[model samples]
Target: MKGRSVILGQINGLEAAALMVDGQLEDLLIDSSGFAPLPPGAICRAKLGRQMKGQGGVFVDLPEGQTGFLREGKGLRPGDTVICQVAGGAEPGKALPVSLRVLFKSRYAIVTPGAPGLNISRRIRDEETRDGLQALADMVMEGSDMGLILRSACEGTEDGEIVEDIAAMRDLAEAVMADLDGAPELLVDAPTPHEEAWREWAEPAPDEVIEGDFATHGVLDAIEALASPRVDLPGSGYMMIEPTRALVAVDVNTGNDTSPAAALKANIIAARELPRQLRLRGLGGQITIDFAPMPKRDRQALEQQLRAAIKGETETSLAGWTPLGNFEMQRKRDRVARAMLIGGTE
Candidate 1:
């Protein structure tokens, strides 16, 4: 109960994975069926479709009459075949988001086919360690044309595993790249929930791993709670998260607290916990936060806390305070909304 644990289990008949740290649910990933035909990270051989006028983008043919939108179509004409990776799920009836850049990502290494270079994560800054990793990369990637990047998770991973990971990804990349004449089909299927957990949660390795029986560990109940919008905060504060057609709205409130610093305290709590809430719920897009009434001078403090909260996030951008005293930010659509998992929303 005091260390990190990964639960690969089924919740309400759906495959799900949860990362629990110190008995608290830190992260969750669920394989949502009907989210899309090709889930994120799926690779396919697709033929370019008609281009969107004034949009600077084109659609690609997917299996079963499905199509994907690719934003980087310059110099490429319709009917041209190109290998693409599924970027993320589409919004309802829209085309699936896709990208021309394909990457074979594992826990230790990410094999890059387009970019050619051997790079180490900046987190590994020690000169001696960096030198050792460089040598390792050179040895493992001998005669390889594709690029290789050692992830931060590689810092404490075993050398043999690191080597195997790099080699495996490189081999997979080679195989994927070699097939060029196939009909539009899936080359690589998206990773499963448990597989994704292993690939992502390998570093800082969990203290324990539990397989199945998610209900035994309260994961099922947690999922139901996550589907709700009212998240209770410290000092009797709470925030309601609602997703709409255009954006996510966060409204903070200090519940029955008479303290003079109630407004600021509620806002501070909201700022710190917002990212975690969004992450567990898989809610992303344009987000606007309406903090409880506070002084204009408090904006700087709230912004500071918010920036610190998102420092570790890669796909979110802090767009700063709005003219109407609201705060806004943008995030990538990485996964299906948690509410959809429980059939709370369409």
Candidate 2:
């Protein structure tokens, strides 16, 4: 498949990544200049500053005003600032590339392995009310600065892990506090890509897995260890997946087939593969798949064949094709698809 390529880097304290799909500039990933110099576990405040137009709270601005989202809540007024951390660099023109948190410190860290919407945060508040509980609740209710969010690494983690993470954050916070006037650096560790994927898949099970051509054996081995069967596709047809401002498109073609029926068969095979692709690739929102046209007699048979192939593959519901020969469907968007595809574990 032919597509552009780009480099991801931190440019002037902002999270910036360049894209060149198909050898063309597809997009550029950029976060706030205020969010420059991102460090793992470092929490920064995002405010609706005077230069910005939207109401204050947590504002995730996108290029060309596409895929931008604003979240407002108590303690997040037009002028009030909310705490956020650079979860990681997001793809260009994507919404909320950076993850935001209401509280800095949490008690229990929630982790979702390999699942897109998987979130990791510390739980600060407890329902059970007692002397210490009341104090902790008050701190959470008041939004104290001492709290820090524990990431997905804390899932099924022993108390020792939580304590160690908290201690690390405390020490880092102390250093920042001590050097109030100087540039401070805090080192926060993020989970490995494999660990993150494990967490997501652990959340919602996958029936089978298809490994990418470029994926490393170690990566595949790690995923396979999680109990999902893996299969490598035959090197015949090729696919190009592009995520645009409007929707995501998957184009398929018989790159090497010579038979007349080969294209139709390949199209049918590709269509059948869509559901699994959507799950494994996490392709959400409106998705369009353009494949080589099939013969009129084969159309319905191909549709049924694809449907049967993808039955019960994911949470997404697939509809039959329209009269125009277009198959339409929607996938849930709990988290960003690029995060999953590009291999990020948070």
Candidate 3:
């Protein structure tokens, strides 16, 4: 309850994994209950469809009459079959976003077909470790045409484990790339929430790993708090995260604070907390934040705070302040919403 804990459980028959740090929910991943036409990270073979003309993308013919939209459609024509990976989660009744640049990713390595290179993650600054990893990559990828990227997780990992991980992924990529006879078929399925938690959250091992039910670890309560409209911030402040049809609107407020700097304090707190809030809630796309009333001079400082908070979030992009004095951002949809994951639908 007071340290980093990884809780795995089931919600409405779907799988879920939650990460709690110092009793606060840091991250959450809930299974999509197979509702997603193409879950994130899914690789498939699809028949290319004609361009939409106005959308700057073409439709892909997925299995079971499902269609995916690929934004990069250069040199592709109707009836041509190409391999693609699910770019992100799909919107309700919309085409699943797919990318022509397929990548095979794992905890320790990423195998990129059609690309050729061997590199190490920049996070691992130890030159000795990088050289050893590069040697291992060369050994395993000697004859391979695809690119091999050793992830940062390889920093302290054992050589045997890293070798095996790279080999397995290399084999998978080779096998999948050769499967050209399929008719709009799924080649690889996405990892389950619990499995992905293990794959991604192993860098800084959690203090505890609770497997089984959620009630024992108070995960249910944390999830319930996320389902609420208001998130209590520091200094008795709070913010309401409301997802409307067009965009997610967050309204911050300073509660019962008459101090002169109350607005700036609350606004800074909101900037620091909004990333995790939006991430855990699985809210994406357009986001508009109306912070507590503060001086225009403080906006730059608050934006700096917000940028620092979301710098590591690859799917989030800070769009800067709008003319209406609201901060706007664009986040790529990477997972199904909490509503759909917990309740199957809104």
Candidate 4:
């Protein structure tokens, strides 16, 4: 997936859940497990784990089992669960850390490293600019217990947008601070939904497109307009793509073929369809494609043809078939393959 998708819930406070495209839950960096209460600024050792439904790693008091989550994109190992002490408590469930003495311990600072063309520090200063920057710093330094990175929105952003974000953070901070003693001790800021972000950032402009029977017409029309001059596959042959933490598999079948050379023809046709399928489905990362088998000679020719077909595509690497007759390939994980396959509808 290109970005994070959020799930909303309430447990004393608002909680946002984020999952990968294939549904592997990420870590949410706030403490949720009830345990010994640590006052704000009290240093205490804790343990942390990456939750499957949020965007960051969660922290917990090691021996107590009370959990806390860290920010997304923080490199966390599945096995390197750590021991951390609370440096301070902010917004109830949120805590700050003092030292990195524990394994897999993430820092409590939010820093957005800048890129060559994307300068994050560059901003438009105005009356609201000063107030917004100060408010953002205050929220990061006080409200959230973990580090915060100013999103790309900070790049080339106007004072008004900055002020708006600052205002949102301020409101969230106020709510969190106010509910520290109430039934909602932990307050969660609503997470921005993926669909809204995708609509704003990655909506494509295509010339012509095709939609499957399962797809909505409005979505299909939008995709068709973006992928103009494209054609859809005919007949009953279908492909199923499944992505897992281990690997991605693409299965191609000859749904309605009735020819004597059905196997060979299906293999060839599937091979021909492979390139388009990969592109249309946005299949990436480590990929394995299995097609109905053909004769040895035809298999060799088909492999060569398929390889040639996808030679110029970006960020795609292909390898010849193995003795077991499956094609092995690699694609960079960036976009959602499922969305592409469904023509960006689902």
Candidate 5:
């Protein structure tokens, strides 16, 4: 219950999936139902709708009445049509958007049609590896208009494979563009959460495993796990997460342990799990964590650990501990919650 978990389910002809960590469902996955599948990274034709006054982005009407926003209008008007890709899911409470900037991703590389340049993943730290990958990317994109971002997985891959990957993506881009006039619908679906998680991490942690009886489980089972905000810790503590209009509140309690050491232990556990919980639930806006009270030095250590735990998140920030020893954090929500995605939000 303290590592990763994967689940796939279907209900009412809608297929859904999820990824969980430490018994908390973190990422939600859903398949497109009608018209055509509008998966991320698939390019399609879209017509511009009315632009929001004072807002930089413009809304567009996607097939099937779903609304998508373009952060930059690129001079497109209400009636003008343009090609766009399903860039990503919408932020919590916002409609999904498409991007004029299209990217095709392989295991080792990300090929961009709009922005042509050589880039490397920031996660790759070794200078020599970065240089090698950059050089390889540059070589592959030598005369092509497409840009390439070399992922960490490309570090040890041969030049031939990398080149072939880039070329394959370029070909896919051409095919998508070519079919735009006749179909003008979604081209392909992005990898599901399960696929993305496995591909990026190579493998889940040793303890990670698929949950539920796959043969009998329904989508509701997965949805329920993701919708709830309460999670119990390994030994004798539990966390309750409640979201208010202004902020998300998380309270940690030492359920059965009363010793001084027990308090510290439970607090540390809560600190480690809190960030994962935030990510799993996709709760955003302001966040406040209330843990069992402890000394200043211990609290400081816990804060440092929490900071280290959430370092990978670009949109999440941790403010220093408050006077009352609580922690405050802010995370930008950019994906719909599972409950809302399934029309089960209350």
Candidate 6:
């Protein structure tokens, strides 16, 4: 397999990074300057602000006017201050203050307080693998109150590494708890998206890292191609992606190759490429994919393969096809729209 490349650029004056695999953009990671710098996995002290009626989550007011979402905290009243960890980041007008869950993310595991037990990644379906990780967790987490979630990255991690990671998180948790008396304080900042991306994929080793600036406009222009409505597939066919005020419509065209076999191949390739486009563009919300007419069996098979490719994506889902033969889907809206990012809008 060809190694990936990392491209860095400026989108709306915020630093951004894009990971490209085999000449195609895999994901575009961007950081905006509008929000306070809170790195993921960092615990912080926050106070409950006014409860927004009809909202599923409560607003947590941190120091310096920073806000957070207490998605699952119970018995919280307005003006009540508590400690919260930065679970996710803030987007322009959406996902602000970041979703503040009390979960601490480590390299090999997630330490969640009050849930005292060990849980393995559901992707590790093999009973033997799950049991092995459970044994390892039990050995290292002796007498610890926090529960551990063994991440997929811990599949083959050494015993010492797991031990060290848990130890570091424990110490960090202890320090945060020690200073809980201070209200509206930031105990820790979350890791930047670029840092997390580098730590995860840089070791597989990228061929090059491109930085985007006024001097590197060519790179940004190339990256912007991913946001285009029409894209040609590798061997044959093409895809037209149209976004409206409601849902995103993706129409697949087999082009000159009309044979059933050729169409199937093209649809499969398009199915694989579509998710990459969504990630690179940060396009989310309801999505409709129209495949070139294929047999029902082949369409079902294609859906399976597509779902497997996007399995871990919490926001995106293949909701099956419509009566009119189009595939219906939904992806949670997360980042700023692609047009805004490409145009460098403020």
| lDDT (Cα, 0-100) at 167 in candidate 3 | 94
Q: Give the alpha carbon lDDT tens digit for every residue of 277-331 in model 6.
A: 7766667778998898888889878998788777656467778988999998887
Candidate achieving the largest TM-score: 3
Question: Model 6 TM-score?
Answer: 0.71
Model 2: which ten-residue window has the lowest total lDDT? Answer: 111-120
lDDT tens per residue, model 3, 192-304: 89989988887677888999888777777878777787999977899999998788999999999979999999989888898898888888889999988888999999999
Task: Indicate the TM-score of model 1.
Answer: 0.93
Identify the superior model by TM-score, candidate 3 or candidate 4: 3
The whole-model lDDT of each prediction reads 0.86, 0.43, 0.86, 0.41, 0.67, 0.70
Per-residue error (Å), model 1, residue 87:
1.5
For every candidate structure, what is the RMSD over all alpha carbons to the true structure, in angstroms?
2.3, 12.6, 2.0, 14.1, 5.5, 4.9
lDDT of 5 at 208: 45
User: How does each model score on TM-score?
Assistant: 0.93, 0.39, 0.94, 0.35, 0.68, 0.71
lDDT of 4 at 85: 29
Model 6 pairs whose backbones collide? 8-212, 38-190, 39-189, 39-190, 39-191, 40-190, 40-191
lDDT string for model 1 (59-158, tens) is: 9997646789999999999998888898766567778878888989998899999889999989888888888889999999999889999988888677
Clash statistics: count for each candidate: 0, 25, 0, 33, 1, 7
Model 4 lDDT, residue 263, Cα: 65
- Estimate the TM-score for candidate 3: 0.94
lDDT of 4 by residue, 1-346 (tens): 2334333222123121222222222211112222224322222333444454553344443333334444432565543433332332233243332223211111111222111111122333454654565555564446334333344345344656554554454454334333323121222211122222222222122122222231222222333332332222345565566655557677777667766676666666666666655554444667887876666777677777777766756456777677888888876432333332233322
Model 5 lDDT per residue over 119-223, tens place: 898878899888877777777677877777877776666878877877777677667655545424556566654555555553333354454443342325545
* Clashes, model 1: 0
lDDT of 5 at 83: 73
Return the TM-score for candidate 5, rounded to 2 decimals: 0.68
